[model samples]
Target: MRELTHVDENGVKMVEVGHKGEVFRKAIAKGRIHLRPETIELIRAGKTKKGNVIAAAQIAGILAVKKTPELIPLCHPILLTGVDLTFEFGEDYIEATCEVRAVYKTGVEMEALTGVSVALLTIWDMVKAVEKDESGQYPVTRIENIHVVEKVKAQVQ
Candidate 1:
């Protein structure tokens, strides 16, 4: 059986990648935020009183990427070379992808994941006013399908 990387016979511990060769590592993660049609229209017209949802979510994604090490236990503090976030809107959902690139021994999958999750959350927050009904309950708003879409490692050029 494959043993857990974050644990040993002695219990939980951070994975050591210090001795590994440095390389260009990139990761892409994606997630979706679901909302009512009315909320989507508010975002499309940039009418949300809270402010520009896309812009705020983009900034939140960037910040989340840079702070991944601090947010997730056992994540290596790698200097990321690039972080990009894009949002695509559907009839009732918004898709967010965060791509993180770094030249380090460890991959940035966690960072990319963190970025996408935070971005989706920011969208949820910005549209909360409309997502609720008179009953003050969220019937449609949800964040889901957060996963790593890709991971690549190569020698730094």
Candidate 2:
């Protein structure tokens, strides 16, 4: 197995990227949130009490990508070139895909993953009223399959 990057003789430390050459990097991440069929319909119809669910989630995902360094320790504050969040609806789930692009020394995989997570959570926030059971707890609502779908770094093409 490869060794961890954030470690040195002094123990644990943030990886220094100053010596690394800058490169164009792009990362795509995805996740899904399962909800009641009713909730899905409400979101698709733009009838959720919280307003447009997809719009809100998209905004949340973009903001999360910008704030990733603050949330995850050791992450460099990269200047992102672009951030896009897309959503797909299934019969009972909403799938979020976050694509982040940057020209920096390090990859943006974590930032993309963070964006997906925030977007899915935002959807949960918008639909909780309809997903909660009589016991005031969710019986079937869940967020799953969070993962990095792709990560690429190379010279400008």
Candidate 3:
């Protein structure tokens, strides 16, 4: 198996990317939050008590991408060129897709992943009041299938 870059015989260390040339990098991640049909309707109808769920989640996702390095240990702070977060609706779910772009020595897959996760979590938070059951538990609400769908990098020049 390949050796781990973050850990070595000495101890955990951030990977040195300064020696590598800058490259155009992009990453896409997607995730979904399952909710009650009624909760979905409330969100669609703009009747949620917390306000516009999609807009709030989109902003949260982009912010999450920019703050990824601060949140995740060992991540290099990257200069992101662009970030886009979009959402789609299903019968009982909302799907979030996050794309991050950068010109840097390292990839932005973690940033994309972070964006999607926070977006979904924001949705969950906004609609939790309606999603919880009599026991105050989220029986049918869940965040699922959070993952990086793509990662690409090429020479910047």
The candidate that wins on TM-score is 3
Clashes by residue pair, model 3: none
Candidate 2 lDDT by residue in tens digits, 38-132: 89999998898889999999999999999999999889999999999999999999999999999999999999999999999998988898999
Per-model lDDT: 0.94, 0.94, 0.95
Report clashes for each candidate as comma-separated counts: 0, 0, 0
Candidate 1: tens digits of C-alpha lDDT, residues 1-157: 9878998999889999979999999999999999998888889999999999999999999999999889988888999899999999999999999999989999999999999999999999898988998999998989999999999999988
lDDT of 3 at 58: 97
Model 3: residues with Cα > 4 Å off, grouped in runs: none
Least lDDT summed over 10 consecutive residues: which range in candidate 2? 3-12
In terms of lDDT, model 3 sits at 0.95
Task: Judging by lDDT, tell me the better candidate of 1 and 2.
Answer: 2
| True-vs-predicted CA distance for residue 48, candidate 3, Å | 0.2
What is the lDDT, from 0 to 100, of the residue 123 in candidate 3?
A: 96
Give all TM-scores, in the order shown.
Answer: 0.97, 0.97, 0.98
